[model samples]
Each structure stands twice: as structure tokens, then as C-alpha cells.
Target: MASDDLFLTPLNALHLELGARMVPFAGYSMPVQYAGLMAEHQHTRTAASLFDVSHMGQLRLSGPDAAAAFESLMPVDVQGLGVNKQRYGLLLNEAGGILDDLMFVNTGEDLFVIVNGACKVNDLAHMQATIGTRCTITPMPDHALLALQGPQAVEVLKRLAPGVESLVFMTGGNFAWGEVPLFVTRSGYTGEDGFEISLHKDQAEAFARALLAEPEVKPAGLGARNSLRLEAGLCLYGNDLDQTTTPVEAAINWAMQKVRRTGGERAGGFPGADFVLAQLDGRLPTERLRVGLIAKERVPVREPAELQNMDGQKVGQVTSGLLSPTLNQPIAMGYVRPEYSIEGTELFAIVRGKPVPMTVTKMPFVPTRYYRG
Candidate 1:
């Protein structure tokens, strides 16, 4: 698509001013890199980095039946979600395939949700069509989302927004920067202690400038964000997950809260619950499972690369791969037969018609540093 036809975020001009290399992503002209990917990635791991994620869809769900009605679409314990708490969720099709992965927060009086930018349109339509009458779903198009990530994030944020130091991981609350109201969540995609703040689009540039003024914080872009998340073993929507992949197959069943599982009081209420529950009980065997692979050599293996067994038999294909900046070794995530999914199992990634040796390894190639306190 043409550049003029692409959507721009509230921080688009700021990104350009900072010399960010722009690229098309999820129908938006977004920054792919600024001050280099490797540098930004390392900075975020050590200190703090600001990422503009305003392209993501934000919505508010209200009404007395909001929680119950929302619970019908995903395998989450929304009824049990406490105020100011957030949880990961998956939107599923009737066939048990994943539609998208999202994060939702229980604000005392309503629900605040963030969905992938690419799937936002269809996701909203689906939710509205299914639960519109039961709840009020209001899209927040005038808001901009910002993710401030790293070990020093708390310290830097506390300097501007007081009382944010009290929030632990997966928790959030309404705060303010001067007169601008902010919804800040102590959570991020990079497996680090961080916060995602949503505020008026008009205040995004000024707020971002203030955050950038901090000595420990630098501007990061999507390229670094991708590598960071990959090192943290987080899933990227189109790559690691898709409409045909099930939560069980994607190895993210942990997101399915126990209360929504079989034998629980609210079991079988969401889409594809029957099939997902069967997989959980081992009554239905999963054909393939997502696992982490470590390349035996330094060569970087990328997605769509064929994964093979000892005799060159096709086992699966790589979904996401990158040379991890932190580990300085190549790592990948892909689907493979259950037998080959075990740790230490030998596998091969076919690259340039040559087989590169790989082993099934535990994920988060780099350890996650989440602050629960």
C-alpha cells in the first residue's frame, strides 16, 4: 500500500523527528527501528525504553452484565477477575481455533481491553455481534497507548506519575500526568517489569517527550520490540498464532484460567470450550505442539523454514525465529509433533536447501524479570 494510504499513530511525527525508519505494519505506518535495533534492544534490557503502540485497539465494556457477557467469547475467568487486575485472554472460533490474543483489565466499573491492531476490526465486530445487547462496547479511537519497559521503568514513571510505584505485575489503576488522565497497567510484552499507559491521543507527543527526558529511557521501535519479545518467548499474533491454531496447540493453555476449564462451575460456556476441554483432559490428542528450538550453529533461521527429523522427514515448519541479541545464539519457535516437542529432542531447520541442526529447548531463552511486588 502507498504511504499516504497508511494509517498514522498519534506519535507518528515524533517518531519521524527521532529519525525512526518507518514501515507498514498492521495497516499503519509505524517505526520499525530508531537508533538501531540492537542498541535499542540492549537498552531496554538494561534500562528503559519507550515504545509507541497506539495502533493497537482499545475498547471499554460496561453495563452490569459486562463481565459475564465478555466471558462468553473467551476462555477466561472474567467473573473472578478482581478490580484493577489484568489477565491474558484468547478469542476463539467455534472450531477451537484461536482468533486473537488480547489483554483485558477489570476497571472497577467497567472493562478495558486491548486487542491486536491487525485483528481489531474483525474482533470488535465479532464481540459486538455476539454480546452487544448484553453490554455496552465503546471503542476508544481517541486514545494512544505507550509502553515504558525495563528494570528502571518504575523509578522513571514514579518521578512523573506518583502512586504508580504501588502497582505490581498485571495490575493497573487510573493515574494522571498533570491534568491528563491516564490508565496505566504494570504489564508489557517484553517479559520485563513495565507499564502500558493509555491516555488522550493529543497528549501523546508531550507525554512521550517527558518520558524521553529521563536519562535512563530511550526511544525504541518495532524492530527492537520484536527481538525483545522473541527473546522473552512471547507470541506474535500472525506468526506464532493464527485463526487455525488452537490455544492447546500454541502452548498457551495457561491463559485459560482453571475456573473456565472442565469440572469447573463455568465450564463449556465459551466458544470451542468442548474441544479445548477435551484436549486438556487428554481425551483428544493434539497433533502438534509449539516448542522452542535452539540452533546448533550461529546461522539465523527464519519463519516458513521446514523442520525435519533425522531422516529428513518433514515434522513441521518454523513460525518465528531470530538471532537473540541477549543470548548471541539463534533461537526459534515452531510447531512439531508431540514426540519431537520434548526438550533435548534433535531437529533440523532446512535453510538454503541445507539442514541446520537444532534442539528442542525451553523457552524464554532469556529469563523474564517480572516484579510481583
Candidate 2:
């Protein structure tokens, strides 16, 4: 049942027409599944899948000091990002806590940023309140975001819009789908070879239907999106990360570029730089580190489940977990004390008051299939 207060994406009507099971997520009525969770999950692994991500916030920052000003807010190399190149970033507060994880692209003329749906309002306010005087902050709520992800995504997209196949990971370019304009980037949250296409909200359903016409493309929903991301070991904002977690503690150290680190040419200017950089450089002590876990048995250990050692003392808690559709094994990611963060360390997940034996493992239980070429 669609609620009156929940916002609807551009494709909301089409989703209902396709018999999608809708659910409220991030204050929007989103499709949980169309065909089914397992079916959509496996289809995305083997073929291309279309996801409606219009609920995410898209905004632009443009000015003479855009890159430099944006860099001062996030702990990433924003000024160093080449034109048309995209980079992952963490928005931090003064206390070194993550406000949100975002993806921003340097499009030569302006910075195009995509933030999580739930935190979009706050993210915009924070950016505007902090750097609005230095740059022009414009929100693009009229743009609809869609992700076409899988190994065959290139083949499906290139047939509709030529030259998309030439794009590599973390890069974007402007293209046209018939008369409609598209801004596409070779990236995705599913850890697959894919593209995130941005277009006008009015043309979204038409474009989506065009993609669906392809034999290789099927519409997936939030259910499979969550499972796919979990299997890929990607962090979910409110689940695996929040205001209480730092980048180092979340184990996403790669998002912080070298230039933002302690001894680089342009360093320690972003929020909480002293603390975050100290942790990154190993000068500051970290209490817990994020780790991957694999269950010994078939039981699925889910989020908020307490982790315990052999002595029955709680050492951690599961943040994300599911029975991986690709690997056919239960896998999870959680924060654990430093000593228990190493691979091959045995731990127990207290599910339903019974300990489920598990072993600390490496992430990407299913290897990422990014198209770097």
C-alpha cells in the first residue's frame, strides 16, 4: 500500500504496473522486488538489472573555488580529481565522525555530487551552511537517477547510447539517448561492471522502458540491491556506518586519497583532519576495526547481532549480513576489537540467544567485476 506521506520516484507508476512489491525506504515508496528477491539477485549477477535510485539526492556546486572548498569538507582529494572523473568521499564532522558517504564527480565546469537519500536534506544544509558563501550550491531534485548494473551492462547500454562502452570505472561523460540527454558514469554500488545514468525526471520512465526492452535487462528493487551490496561487502550508510563511525573504523581507508593524508602537499584542511589523519597514519589509537565474517553453519546472522569470543564476552556486533546468493554461504561485515579483526579468527554470533560459530574472513565474498577498461 502506497502511503500519502511517502514520496514517489519518477518510475513509481511503472513499478506498480510491473507488479512490484513496494516498501517504504528513506521516506520514499520504493520497490522491494519485482519478480522476487532470489530471482532478481541471481539475474543481476548473471545479467543486467535496472534499479530506480531517484530517491538519492543530486546537487551541483560551481564556482571559482568549488574544488578547493569541497575538499575542505571531505577527507578526499577533490581538487585533484580529473575532469569527468568521479571519486568516493566521506563527509565528516569536527569530531571525526562520518556524516554521510557520497560520490562526487569533477565535470570540469562544476562538481556533481550524489548523496544518500536519507541524509540528503542534512547534507545539503551542512554544505550550504559551511561553504555556501564560497561556492554556488544548487540542488537538482528534478533529476532522476538510475543504475544499470552487471557484466553485460555495457553491451545493453552501448546499443542505446553509443560511446558508453569507452568509459572506464569512476569516469563519466555526457551522452544522448535519442532526443533526451544523459549524464552517465561507469560506476555502481553493486560492485559490478555497470553505469549510473542521470536524466530528466520527465524522461525517466521512457528511458527505463527502453532499457527494459533489451533482453538482458530486468528491473530489480531494493531487496536485491541490499543483498547484492552485502555480498559485495559494500557498506550501507545507516547500517554499517553512521555518525559514530570513522572511515578508519569502517575499514574504508581507500576513499581517503594520499593528498588528504598527513604528509601530502595539501593535507589536514578538511573537517576532523587532525584526528582522521592521525588515525590513518597510525599515530592515533583505534578501538575497533571493521571485518568480514563467514558463518560455519547455514544460519544467517543479521545486523545488530552481538559477537562474542570463546569466553562468551562480547567483542563486536554484526552490521550487515546475508546468505550470499553468488557464494551460497552466509557472510557478514561488522565492527570488532582490533585483536579479533584479523582473518581466520574464530568468533560467535549470538542469534536468538544461541552462538553461531563463524570465522573472520576477507571482504567481497563475491569478487568485484568492475570494468576498468
Candidate 3:
């Protein structure tokens, strides 16, 4: 690799051997494709696919007051989250702006946390500077994160780990991959039955190879990963969410535990709690909320395109838009006026200065395939 080349994950060599097209994402040279987006996507839906997601940051939080201290910046009821279960949430700024969306999974009574790769450095710095007194945050950069997702993910997983087939979503446990310590979580971004395996960096290659040896598992890339998440109606942090977006407008109110709501016990202590609470108290109408839009034609809409009402009044702009391989249509997610957010509501998208007919539709462009078993 050249001096200016991006960093490579432990699975980089494995991905290269599989003919993956590598690209720079979040400062890491990751695969964007192996076969093709459509093929890779369908393979995952019908079978299983493995993804190298080590670029994401993993951290452990501990101390006497770990859970309480971490909740100071997040809007979720962190303390009440059960051990071995994970919850998604946002890290907000003082003004209610989102710093980043993350996941917190309780590994033990004193430890929990997982953050985004793009913001991990700053997230750690900010958390330490602000809440260091009550908790100690340790970044686990030595580990690699890999995801195996699809309808057959469980079956493929059970080939190595018994009892994995019964693991519920958003849950995790300590396991072993041929005697090597592994932390396997029954969660993924693809909205399918899967697991995100966190393991020693040195073990990534061997583990991935073992999984690929199965007839059901194929190597997937970033292109299919994006499409799969879109099909599942999940948000991409930087594209769908940013410092300017709030959890309310993003339609992620479920992430806020009831105890963290306004006037409830333990309320108004997180960052921008006043603004968030006021928004939750009917003071905010959720005027512009996240919704899916189906374009009239095959013309894929990209970000920053204007969304218009029936009367041609501009309402909002698309945050993340793309042609969904699974749905075989152009699908997009954007904030639209609440009045126009109802399913089947007709709307228009300003595409290249022209109004393209659109309709407000239910999200997860393709129905999610989460394993409820």
C-alpha cells in the first residue's frame, strides 16, 4: 500500500482473494463489490452473505457509575437495558444536534458501548472530557467486526456455534470460534437473521474463511450492504443523520425509553434534553419526518433534491436516495411535511429542475426479513 493509501482491515487480503472491488470508506480500504450489487443482494436475501465491517469502532465502558454517566449524553434509559441485549440510540449535542447514532450493549454490570467508526475518535474524546469522572471508556481497536446476514444466516452460524440459531435479535453472548474468544451479537444492518462477530484482529481472516467455506455463505461488499439496509429501511448515520438532524424528525422515537421522556423520572438530564423533551411534549409537530418516496420512473434520486407538495410547494429535500436492487425501483428516504407523510399520499420530487411524480410510501422499501423464530 502507498503512504497515502487508506488503512486496511484484517480481512483485506481475504476480500482481495475473493475479487472484491476495494474503495476508501471512513478512512478504511473496504470492499464495495465482489460479484455485483444485484447478485450479492439476492444471494443474501435467499441465502447468506458475510461482510467485513471492522471499520466500525468498538468500545467498552466501565466504572462504578458507568451506565448513569453514559446516559448523560444519550437520550436512552441506559441503566435499564438488560445485559446481553443491545439498544440503538443517538449521541446528541447541547443544542439537540446529533453527534452520531450508536449502539450500546451491556456485556456485564459494569461494561457497555459500541460507536460509529467515523466519529469514534471524537466521541471518545468528548465522552472522556465530559464524563470521565463517573466512567472509564476504553477503545477496542484491536478487534475486528464481521457480519453474516440473510435468511440462512442462522443455519450457517449453527454450523459452528450451537444454540446460535435461537439467538434473538439485538442480543449477544460470549462464545468461541474453535477455542478463540468471540463475542457474537444477533444483530445486523440488513434486517435479516444474522450475527455481528467481534473477535481478535488476528483471527478475522481464519474465521471469515471458515464461514465462506460453507456452501451458503458468500462475500458481500459495501454496495450490497447499502442496498440491503435501504431495503430494510435503516438509516445511514452521515447521509440520513448528521449534526443538523434530530431523533424526533428521524422517526426514531422508539429509541427513547419512556423513563427518559418529559416529566418522567430521570428526565431532562441528557444533552439538549430540554429541546428534545419540548419536542416530545406536542410542542413539536414532527412536521418533517422520515418517509420513503417511490419515484415515478427509474431515475434514481440522489441527496439534496427538493421534495414538493401537490401544489408545487417545496417541503423538504431527500437525505439518502438510491435505486433499490431488491425492490427493482428507485427508493428514497427524506423528511417531508407531516401532512404529506401518510402512506399513498401523492407528492413530487424535483429532479434536475423538473418535477417527477412521487408517492409517500411505507418504508423498508422491501419488507424486512428479521428472523422472529
Candidate 4:
């Protein structure tokens, strides 16, 4: 893609001023790093980092049938979600494959949605096509989304927006940063106590500047964001998940509540619910499963690397991998044959035709520090 074809966010100028290295991501010119990837990654873990996620899409759904109609598109308890509560959801196809992963909040009178940057267009179209007649779908293209993440995020944000401190994980409410109208969710891609703030584009620069003015908050980019989420064992839509992968195969079946399962009150109404539910109940077989791998040797195994067993026969392939900045070791997530999904099972990653020893292990390579209370 040409540089001229790239889209800019509300914080584009601010990011340039802060010495961020901008890169093309999902049709937008986004900051990939500031200071450096490693430094930014560590800063977010220890303190707070502000990320410009405005490139992602935001939408509002209203009307009497909004919740029920929206619930029919994904396997989750959207109708039962309490006011100001949020949940992670998956967009599935007829074959039980993931279309895109998203987050939705039942904010009193309306449903607020946030979808991946790369898939926002398709996601919007899909929703409109399926539920247009049942509800009001309003796209918020003029909004800016920001994520303030880490252990000290609450401390930093609450000082500016009161009542934010009272929020627990997966809950959110309307708040303000001085005169700016803000809708904040106590959730984030990183496995940390954080908040994702949605505000109008006009005030994004001023608000982002205000947040950066805080001593606890620093500007971070997409590079650091990816590393942080990976450490938390979160899935990146295009990388670890895609149209060909199902929630059950991705090991994220937990997001599908019992209400959408085989025998619940509102069971099997969403797309691909039948196969997904069967897989959930052990009636359907999965060819492979997503698992976390820790490299025994120091070599870093990256995506597209083939996985092999003791006999050197290929069993699966690596989807995402890197040298974990926190652990100071190499960690990766990948899909493997069902029989090879056991924790502690030894495997090898083909890096440059050489076998690098690795072991399957539980995820969240670095333990998550979510604030539930």
C-alpha cells in the first residue's frame, strides 16, 4: 500500500511529535513504537501506557430489538448482560469458523460495540445485513478510542475521571475528562487493570495530551501493544484467529455462555451454534487445538514455523511467537494435532530447517494481573 493511501488517527500529529515510528496497519498510519518496543513494553507492564486505537471501528445499536437481534449473530448472552457490563464475543459463520472477535457493552439504553481494525468494514456490513431490520445500527466513524493500560492505570485515570475507581473488570460507565464526554470500559487486550476510553475525534488530541501529561502514563505504539497482549495470552484476530478457525479450535469456547449452548434457555440461535455447541459438549471432534509453547532452547520461533514431534513428522504450525521481554525467554502460541495438545508434551519448531525444542504449556506466559475486585 502507498503511504498516501494510509489513514491518520486523531493522535497522528501527537505521535509524530513524541517521536513514534509510524507504520501501516489495517489501512491506517499507526505508531508501531516510541522510545523502543522493549522499553515501551516494559513501561506498560510496570506503569501505564496510552495507545491510539482510533483506527478500530466503533458502533452503536439501539431500538427495542437491539439486544435480541444482536444476540442472534454471536454465541453469547447479550440479552442477559446487565447494564454497563461488557463481554467478549465471537462472530461465527455457518461452518462454525470465526469471522471476527469483538467486544460489546450493554450501556443502559444501547449496545456499544468495538471491532478489530482490519475487519471493521466487513463486520459492519455483516451486522447490517443480518440485523438491520430489527435494530438501529449507527457507525461512529468520527470517534477516537484510547487504551490506558497497566497496574497504575486506574490510579492515573480516576484522578481525572472520578467514579472510574469503583468499576471492576468487565464493567463500564459514562465518565468525563474535564469537558470531554467519555465512555470508558474497565477492559483491555492486555491482561492488566486498564480502561478503554471512547470519545469524539475532535477532543482526542487534547485528551490524549492530558493523559500523557500524567507522570504515570507514557505513549506506546502497536508494537508494544502486540507484545503486551501476547504476554497476556490474548488472541490477535488475523494472526491466531481467522475465518478458518473456530472458537472451540481456538480454545476460546469459554466466551460462549451456556445460554447459547446445547440445552440452555436461548440455545443454538446464533450462526454455527450447532457445531460449536457439539464441540463444547464433546460430541464433535476437533482436528487441532490452540496451545502455548515455551521454547526449551533460546532460539525464537515465529509464525509459519512448522511443528514436529519426536519422529520429525510435521504435526502443526506456529501462529505467533517472540522472545518474551518479561520472561527473558522465547514463547509462542500455535495449533497442534489434538493428541499433541497436552501440557508438557515435547515438540520441535522448524526454524531454518533446524529443530528447536519446545514444550506445550498453559498460556498467559506472564501471569495476568486483572483487577476483579
True-structure RMSD, every candidate: 1.2, 1.3, 1.7, 1.3
For residue 237, model 4's alpha carbon misses the true position, in angstroms, by 0.4
Q: Candidate 3, residues 1-373: lDDT per residue as tens digits? A: 3225688899988888989998888888999999998899999999999999998988888987998888888899888888888889789998787899988788885555677778888888988898887887888988999999998988888888777766788888887877888888888999778899999998889999999999999999999999889878899988888888778888888889888886666877999887777777778555678898898888888788899988889888888888888777888899887788889988888888988787888877888777555
Q: Give per-residue CA lDDT, model 2, range 1-373, as digits (tens).
A: 2368999999999999999999999999999999998999999989999999999999999999998999999889998899999999899999789999999999999999999999999999999999999999999999999999998999999999999999999999899999899999999999889999999999999999999999999999999999999888899999999999989999999998877785766877888888888888789988999999999999999999999999999999999998888878888999999999999999999999999999999888889999886
Query: How does each model score on lDDT?
Result: 0.94, 0.93, 0.85, 0.93
Model 2 spans > 4 angstroms off? 1-3
TM-scores, one per candidate: 0.99, 0.98, 0.96, 0.98
Per lDDT, what order, best first? 1, 2, 4, 3
For candidate 3, give the lDDT of residue 134: 82
- The collision pairs in model 4 are none
Cα shift from native, residue 83, model 3 (Å): 1.6
Off by over 4 Å in 4: 1-3
Q: Candidate 2 at residue 338, lDDT?
A: 94
In TM-score terms, candidate 1 sits at 0.99
For model 3, the superposed segments whose C-alpha errors exceed 4 Å read 1-5, 285-287
